[model samples]
Target: MNLLFSNDKRGDYPQSWYAASADLLAPFAPLGGVQRADVCVVGGGYTGLSAALHLAEAGLDVVLLEAHRVGFGASGRNGGQLGSGQRLDQLKLEKMLGAEDARRMWEFGEEAKALVRGLVERHGIDCHLRDGVGWAGSSAGSVAELHDYAAHMDARYGYGLEVLDREAFAALCRSPDFQGGVLDMGAAHLHPLRLALGLAEACVRAGVRIYERSHVHHIQHGSKVVVQTDAGRVEADHLILGCNGYLGGLDRKVAARVMPINNFIVATEPLGDRAAEVLTRDVALCDDRFVVNYWKLSDDKRLLFGGGESYGYRFPSDIRAVVRKPLAQIYPHLADVKLEYAWGGTLAITMKRLPHLARVAPNVLSASGYSGHGVGNAVQAGKLMAEAVRGQASGFDAFAALPTPAFPGGAGLRTPLLALAMSWFALRDKLGL
Candidate 1:
């Protein structure tokens, strides 16, 4: 069961709404024979593409390899929410790494979001970049904590988020289940696949060589790294592993700390004027749950709802109905609506929920485990990795200092144990605990 080929075909993007809407580029030829570059990036998602773009812009020869098309994985099929701050809450980070370091991390998160915005504007990527993200709460206790956290962010980090009470949130979200929430104007949403495609085009314009269907099977490490694919090989001064959830068995250390999980999403038929019922504004809504329910209206007035999680590698048979169970909970009016498209994607997660950035070797670096906060973090990780290769390592150091532990049960049993733990949490979410 190779993740790259198990559920999908070679060179084919997932049948997602993002794929249908995005202006995809002609497929890049796969790597053949042998090649050499200053940097060889494995994986063509946001992280690898950004690294290739930055390194190329810095006048370094860069080569990027993807098993499938660019943005073929979670990069194209996610909820598309550009969240504020790191995957872990700021207060939790403050306790884990202390206030000074936590403040630095917060600034890094701000930099992450700003990097995405700057790239989109600078490259003229028309990904429907919209502002505002509503962090809704379902229970009264959760609502109070949301308010407290918003105030804490304002006082300590000067975040300045808008706190919405139950009534106010209902007026905007039109959800009966939401008790309250906080609206972060700093956060935003977009067409994820379009953004990825734009970044890929930018990489090409910057002189980076991109090869699709070039699956990297092994990496020979030494003074210089040689990344071996099925049909070709790439020897480079630096190697970057940006494969995220799809990185199976390539590196033991990363595979130990970062566990892959499957998530599903569904896009409803165009709602026309009814789009305003779910979202009065164009903002996205994501609830605070172990298995979160995230949704937003597409430009064509379709509701793109993402939910449901599977611990194993295989996606469920019916992804749309799995997501619909939760989608209807948030928008009951859409219970009987038609689903236009449904798809599933895999992403990496760490024990602490923070991204895992490590040197891996003297000249090799890897970053993954953004834990559903990949949109901003993955781009920043790539920039920082590129900076480290250029001899400035402060940004990478900040992330490398974060603690990421391996799963307790190791490779064989970790998935089952994680399934049990996630099931418990999901039960608690349903019980409103």
Candidate 2:
């Protein structure tokens, strides 16, 4: 089944809290007849919008196509946590890619966060950008590991983090379940949908043509690539696949490495007088679990809690119930609060939890599989892809050199196999392993 159309209505945004509050732009008409550009970007989320904006600013004729509205996918529906490092931890990356490359990767990750901040400031995009992200630990061992990692980051990378004991953590989070935590001042959170829509507005201002509700049917590869849509086609000197989890059968090589998965989130009704009881500060919190529970207070004093995962193609029917279990586990006092919104979105995951950036052809590039850390990395990937199209490919090449193995059993059986594996992991998480 096509992920883009399977779980959501065509050309319509999901009934998410993000959508409810966003200042959405007028819809861009679908592509018609024929079109040509110096670069054709498929997907209108962070990656594609950023790429199109940068490419157009460089004086390249750019066109970006989205099957739905901008930010209608995971970009708008995610937990909105802009994490500090790559998906994998530094020590693990050092072991996998060695010290020198790992150091470079760390710099890239820092640059990713800086890029997001700079873009927001330069473009005047007001998305309630706020600093501080706390990592809450589940067990004593996990707490100790997080404390050590915070020290490692400080000593090795000069990144400061405030380590919190159980008492201090509870004071801030008001959750007795957390053993300890660490707060990273460098990381931040924002209104994800507003950030995306702002970027789309900036892209349009920079002369990038955006087409919504234009689904790509196929791509004919050649020196000048031809991207086919239902009502029209785009012939371009360069093609970029930023479709992420919504990318169907556009490119077989990319499909093999980037697997789509569903994740859900729910928002509580506005808790005016009791907002401080849930979160003392307006910072985001994420726990150490295989299936993590992340939450933060919205600007309107509502708790935006994101949790639960479904291995299948579709989301659970009762998304609120799926998320409420974890929400209550952390904040039992707010267990019976009214849920105003519950929604799900698709995201791409890889075996190694690292992003996959590849040059499918000399003129065709693809980047996805950011795991859960796409807020920063995805935007950086877009800029790097734009650089590659502009004849400076060192950055893109560095990311492309990373390993991205295909899932076993190919396309048909990989989902079921992953489901079985995830069930075991979920059990381990439940058992406190």
Candidate 3:
């Protein structure tokens, strides 16, 4: 089944805490007739919105189409952590691409964070943005690895992160399971949906024509690309594909290299003063599990936790129950805590875990496979694509330089193989291997 229409309504946002909390904009009219622009942006998540905003600010005619409301996908429904580096960390980059190129990649990570912060400030997007994301570990060995990684970043890249000892970490994260961790004050977290809506508003103010519920089904690529939706069509000098997990078969090359996966998150009932029992400080905590458990406290003092084990084509019947298993693992005291909202989202991942940025055609550019590091990377990818369209491609080139391989089993077999692999990783995580 087509993922876009598989599990959700055509033009509605998911029933997420974000959708409930965000002050959404009125729906933009769907595209109905032939349209032409300097740039055509498909998918209205961070990447498409950012690209449209940047291109429009530069005086280009831009049109953005979204099958659902803007930010209706993973952009609005993720863990909301603005991570420090790419999905693959710096040390791995050093080995894979050499020190010089790795350093450039590090700088790109810095730029990515800066761009998010800058946009929030410049556009006055009240996303509840805050600093300090903790990397907590359950075991002593895992904690040691965190400390070493922090020191390596500080000494080699001058990243200056705070290394917390067991007691010190316990002061920040009241969870008894965490022995120690590294706190990156440079990293931040916020309301993801608010950031996306803010970017969409910025795009409108910059003169972009945004058409909601405009599902693109086909394309005719040439000197000038033609993007066809059911109701209308767009012919533009350049095309930007930011569909991420929802891209489906629109482009087979992207579908080959970028595999889509679903993730779930849940928000607990307002904890009142008991929020301190979960997090002593207002920092986000992410564990070192292969499946990765992440959480933060919402402004209303609700525990927003993300983790689970559902590896099927469709989201599990009960998302809250799926995430509750891991949520209890981290905070057993709150095992039966009331979940106020629960939702699932899909995002793409590549073989190397780095984002896939490519010029599928000379005039058609695509970016996906953020691998859960999409907050900063997606925004940066959009800016890079915008710059590339204007003849400045160095920023985009850095990401495009990384290797992304096609799934070994192709479309049909990749999901089952991944499910088997994930089961193995989950077992290892449980055994603390």
Candidate 4:
């Protein structure tokens, strides 16, 4: 099945409140003929743009090809919660990779967050960058777990988190649904599309050649790699495949290690004073559930609620309908609010619940499987990939050393197996198991 074209046609940016408020920018031209550069990056989202910007700044000629426009992928459509650490817990990482390596990973995440803030300031990217994020508990058990986790972070990692009890949590969020939660000031939220567009512009300023609508059809790997697109080609000493979940069939081996999962989001009409009633703090909100509910109030006061997932490539016909129930479950007061927009994007996941970063072939590096935690990690991945290409590779090698198991079934049956596995997890969530 040609999942890419099908999803591409169906995946129009659904009247998002962000899109409505963002400043208009000029479009990039598509690739037309053969070209050459020191590096060719596929997928022009945060990862690609970051890599391109860093490489170009280092005086390496860089060519970035995007199938659509920059930020058209998950980079633009995400919930904009820039949280710390990977998708998996730090304790889990410590257990899996040892304490020393896990500490390095944690520091890397902090650096990623710092890098984002620095870029925003350096480029004057006005994307509504805000401090702090809330991890609210969906149940009593989850509340206890959150408190314990907070204590763990404080004791083991010297991280400070404001732990709130039920009453205090309700006061902080103005929602009766949450039992309690932890607020980490280190994490944050922002207008993701704006940030991505700013990065693309910065890359151009740094002399990176960016081409939109340039879908790479094939990659001929050798001493120097040659990437072929329908209208153009790029020969480079290094190639960085940052396509993530939308990779399509670019490389079968790399594709098999990451499964594409579809996640959807909805935006409600500006609630004005009513928004403040629901969320006292403007911090981004996320729940402690298997199918987590993540949301935040936009600069314009519209609530950007994100939830719902499909393991297969197909998206729900009525995204709002799929998400409304979950939204209501969290804040019943907003049940009647008019949904202004709905959209969906794909994120890659691995069986081990860790990012898959490795060299698929000689001189060909790929990084994906961030799961739903790409905001900070993807940027770091791009920077690390650039460093690797420049011969300083210890940081990138650390990620490449992480074990990532491919789907049990090969490409043909992988989708079905993943659907079943995710369905089971959703069922467990429903049963509170």
Candidate 5:
């Protein structure tokens, strides 16, 4: 399958509600000729921009190249849930990599949230940041599990969480589908595209050079790395690859470590009084299932519903049709609501459901495979990459040390195998497994 990035230009912005709502305020020229910098970062999304900001602040001459406009990929199209921690549960992480490492990982997630908050305030980014996120249970069994999970977090990690009964949760969400859930104050939701744009602006203000529409086609690595774009080239002491699922053949090793999965979302027409009756609070709500339904009310009172995943490279012909069922399953009243816009974005996934961070070569680093949890982890990965390049490799090494196995059957057969495996999980979700 041709990579998503290899396809023809899909236009600057998708018809998602976020793009329609948020104000994009920055514009940068594309790379025109050969340039030299202390660090050359590829992909102008959150990861690349964050790395550029940190490196430039450290006095490194940083140059960032994006294939399209900044935040044109998943960074602009995500559900905007600033979720806490890695994709795996804390206990699961502890079991996988000892308690000491798990605690440090948890701390890193905390720092990620704090970093986002600090950048928003320090850079004066108007991304509509808010607190509190609810994890709605899809079934009674999941409700019990959430309650247990909440209790464990409070007991072991001392993380404050409110466990809501079915009645309380239904009152909060105004949905009968969920039995109960947990409300975590630490997690949050925000305007993702705005945040991405803000980071790009911040990078520029920090004296980092940004080149838009400069797709990196090749790289020559040695003591110093040289990145070649379609129209220009960049020579730098270090190179950072931040393109997630849209990453093409720029680096085959990092590309093979992740499987690109396409996900879609839909935004409903403004509900006015009807929206108020649907959600008691403005907090984002995500269900507990393999293929979870995550929704939140936009500041404009539109319902931004996100769900549905595809292992194939091509997006579904009718994205709304593929997402409507899941949206209705959560909010049956919304079955009649008019969907204003629908769009899809691709994300990278790993077999162990963990992010893949590693060094492809000396002075060359790459991080992807955030799965469905890129909002926070991606930013953290960029910060860690900066630290590694600055010679403080302890934290970065911890994550880079995590084992990332290659996809089975190589790239040729990986997508089909992933589709087959994901189908079993989707079936389990339907059976309430």
Candidate 6:
């Protein structure tokens, strides 16, 4: 089954808290006839929208096609935490790509956050952007390691982080599972769907032709790339694949390197004053679990908790139940609380847990496999692709130079293989290994 059509209704967003609470824009019409543009961007998440917006601003005729609505994918349904750095820590990156490249990567990651903030401010996208992300250690050893990493980032890059001891962390998080934690003041959180819809509005204002519900089924690669949807087509000078997890057989090379996975989240009933009893602060929180659990209080004081993953095509029938177990693990008092909303989203990951940016063809660029750091990475990837299309490719080349290995069984068998590997890691996490 195609991930684009799996688990969710065609041409509809999931019944997510983000969707319910967002000021969603009126749906853009699907593409219905042949069109020509300077660039055709497939997939209407952050990457496509941002790229289209930037390109249009640069006086390029841009067409962005989305299977359903803009931001209807992981961009609208994620944890909404825009944390510091890439999916892999910078220290690990130093060893993998050497200090120079790693340092450049870190700088790019930092600039990604700045880009998001600048976009929001300049375009007036009111997505409740807030700073401070908490990194709680799952174990004492994990806690110590987090502390050391905090120091490392602060010393190396002058990144600001407040390391909290056990008592202070407990006062802020009120979680027995979370002892001491580090608060990255530079990181941020926001209403993801609002940000996406806001960007779509900005794109339209910037002259981007956005076609919603226009699913791309085939692509003809050449000097003039042709993108085919059921009732419409786009011929453009450049093509960008921002499909991420929803990409299905669009490009074989990208498919081999990027694997899609499902994640679930739930929002609890408004906690009122009890919100302070649970989390004394407004910081977004995440732990060091192999399958990480992240949570924060919504503007209305509801607890928005994201956890659980499945190595399958379908989301669990009862997403609420699937997430409740982990919610109990972190906050027992909220275990039986009323679930206001529960939803699942698909996101892609690379073998090394870093984003994969590649020039799949001379004029066709693809960016995906952001792991859990898409909020910042996706937007930056979009801007870099926009730059590359204008013949300024140094930034894009830097990202493309990072190695992205194909999965052992490629895309077809990766599901089963990933299932086995994730099960092993989950078991190790249970055993605290």
Structural similarity to truth (TM-score) of each candidate: 0.99, 0.99, 0.99, 0.97, 0.97, 0.99
lDDT tens digits by residue: candidate 3, 28-69: 999998999999999999999999999999999999999999
Of models 2 and 4, which has the larger TM-score? 2
Give the Cα error of residue 271 in candidate 4, in Å. 0.1
lDDT of 4 by residue, 254-361 (tens): 888988888989999889989886688879989887878899898778889999898776788899999998898888888889998888888888888788888887
After superposing candidate 4, which stretches have Cα over 4 Å from the reference? 9-14
lDDT by residue (tens digit), candidate 6, 1-433: 7899989899999999999999888889999989999999998999999899999999999999999999999999999999888889888999999988889999898999999999999999989999989999877888888889888888987887898888889989977877788998789999999999999999999999999999999999999999999998999999999999999899989989999999999999999988986788788998888888899999999999999899768999999999998899889877668998999999999999989999999999999999999999999999999999999999999989898899997656888999898988888887889
Global fold similarity of model 6 (TM-score):
0.99
What is the lDDT of every predicted structure here? 0.93, 0.92, 0.92, 0.86, 0.86, 0.92
Report the lDDT tens digits of candidate 2 across residue range 240-297: 9998998889999999999999999999999998888798988999999988889999
Model 2 residue 420 CA deviation (Å) reads 1.3
- State the local distance difference test value for candidate 5: 0.86
- Tell me the lDDT of candidate 6: 0.92
What's the CA error at residue 347 for candidate 5, in Å? 1.0
Clashes of each: 0, 0, 0, 0, 0, 0
Q: Lowest summed-lDDT stretch of 10 residues in model 6? A: 328-337
Instruction: Give the local distance difference test score of model 3.
Output: 0.92
